[model samples]
Target: MAVAKLLLLILGGVAQLYGQTPPNVRPPTEHLREQRGIERGLPFVKWCCFASGCFSRPPSSSHSRTLPHPHSLTISRTSSHLSSSPKPPRSPSLPPAFTIGILLCVFGGLIRAYCYRALGAHFTFELSIRPKQALVTHGVYGVIRHPSYTGAFGLGVGMILCVFDRRGVIMSLVASAVASGGGSDNDQAVVTATLTCVCVTLLCILYFGFTKRMNNEDAMLEKHFGEEWRAWAKRVPYWLVPGVY
Candidate 1:
């Protein structure tokens, strides 16, 4: 039952990401965008999209020469389809943490979907507001100024947690560490401490990146929309988390 939830969450998220992508876009442009990202700074802007199977190798590159328009995306295919990855060698099952991660992913994807519907043509992974784009305030935007960034942060953290299960990388490392200690009580404590530190570090890093993106978006929207943006921001003081952020 729990595993079903994880798979369904992944699929639903993928559907939202890919189904919303405009078809006229292509992959070589995406490659060029990443190249520009590398020149500007770290390429973490699209990290959450990867977790939900949004990035894929561009089909033959001959189709795309010009950079894709800012409003439209060119995510070519979904390489990490759940039905396609090699059947994970079975263990007892996915961990409780994996289920927790799945729930977070579901929550995040639903938020993104809401933003998509709210923003309509303005919803995009790239960060450029269309000319005369109205500042969205209904739905999730009514409470949070940058709901998309909030959703992306949750999606990234959930992806990290999902990797700590039987079929993922973190658990394998944990098991090895547990074995190396000869199963001592001290080993258990050390392992727990180390794992906690690692997870916190990762989540913190993801949060920081998303926060930066949100701040940038806020500045850009305020510049573009002027007083209209200011009014929306005033009403929705929170960027990522309500009452906390």
Candidate 2:
């Protein structure tokens, strides 16, 4: 009888603990948006949409000859059915710490948006080979050749900033260092996640920091404008940081 009572008490405690778990611990997507604010939500959607399909579709046949507007690019033969593709699974609602983390991410995002607005037509997340595409050397680009990259790196750090108390920052820094340094890992799951995040962060930064994106854009420009791009390239000797590279 004593053993039976103890077992019942143990079960009761387990149930109580489960009940004590906060509903806010895992709220809805709308709730997360509410926390991050509407201004930041749009950019999050834009990046998510871009990652989902916007960047993957091939350009239209005439897209190389002439610059297609953002809307037109979406309706092209290669992209017409992109919306029909199966949607990716949604992430679980943000936890408490994640709410704070998203705010930090928003600050970084705003920094990039400011740079983008300053860049206007010069701002592109992908490599464009259009004739009208000019080498942007004004505003933020004038100060830091790859302000976009610095903003993005800041975003990566921000996403985890408020998520884990004291240990969170330490863990995030370790992860960043390990991933950036290309440290090896024995665990397949850990290795896969680390490498994926690192690769994506690097790619985003390289889009503005490295010459590869510029070179690809130049290839397109050379095909279209030829001498115009040659002259521009001469003026912009380095792809990223002006003095360093």
Candidate 3:
């Protein structure tokens, strides 16, 4: 089941890469961009997601690591040591947490596709109103005013966890390095602190940015569409999540 899920994710991701329509690229206003707070996190987050993929594969008898084996390290306050035992073989099964994250990734990916179809060419990564663009209110928008953002938030959570979990990319890399150098537990502690800081900052930035961006869009649309926007806002009061602001 885990292999099947991973296969599905890989196939879906490949298909999306081949034929995805990117959101509108027009830069948002300076004020809006500042409120967005995604300038740095965007690429940082993406790099983390992509780099984490190399750690996901099961170790095959056919392949070996150039660096110290990530799983060989045992760091303690007294010392860091490497295991001398030959590695045991394992299947491609995923951790329960990772499996849940992958599910969220797929769910969010589908919702993003839905939003792309619904919005057509109006979807913009940065806040920008196109000339004479019609307001989109049917379908997902009927449930929540900012469905794309909901998908993004879900996707972002999955992506972050995939790289930051206990048995994840960060720990794997840190373990390998520590094993090679005989580093202390402090190294792991520092990494943990950094990861926690990044996650907290990411959540805060995204929350404030999504909220600000949505309201900014609403204000712009209301100005442009007059009663049309007002009626839609009246009908759907929620922003990203339904019934929870």
Global fold similarity of model 1 (TM-score): 0.63
The segments of candidate 1 whose C-alpha lies over 4 angstroms from its true place after superposition are: 1-94, 166-169, 176-183
Colliding pairs, model 3? none
Better of 1 and 3 by lDDT: 3
Encode model 2's per-residue lDDT on 149-232: one tens digit a residue: 555544444433332222223334444455456554433347446645765665555344434444444565566667765666
Greater-TM-score candidate between 1 and 2: 1
Could you give candidate 3's per-residue lDDT for residues 89-154 as a string of tens digits? 464445565566666666767888788788867775555566668888888889898887787676
TM per candidate comes to 0.63, 0.34, 0.68
Q: What lDDT would each prediction earn against the true structure? A: 0.57, 0.43, 0.62
Error of 1 at 76 (Å): 52
| Candidate 1 local lDDT, residue 183 | 61
Residue 8 miss distance in model 1 (angstroms): 5.0
Error of 3 at 159 (Å): 1.0
Overall local distance difference test of candidate 2? 0.43
For each of the candidates, the C-alpha root-mean-square deviation to the true structure, in angstroms, is 15.8, 25.4, 6.5
Candidate 3 lDDT trough over 10 residues, lowest sum:
58-67
Off by over 4 Å in 3: 1-92, 179-190
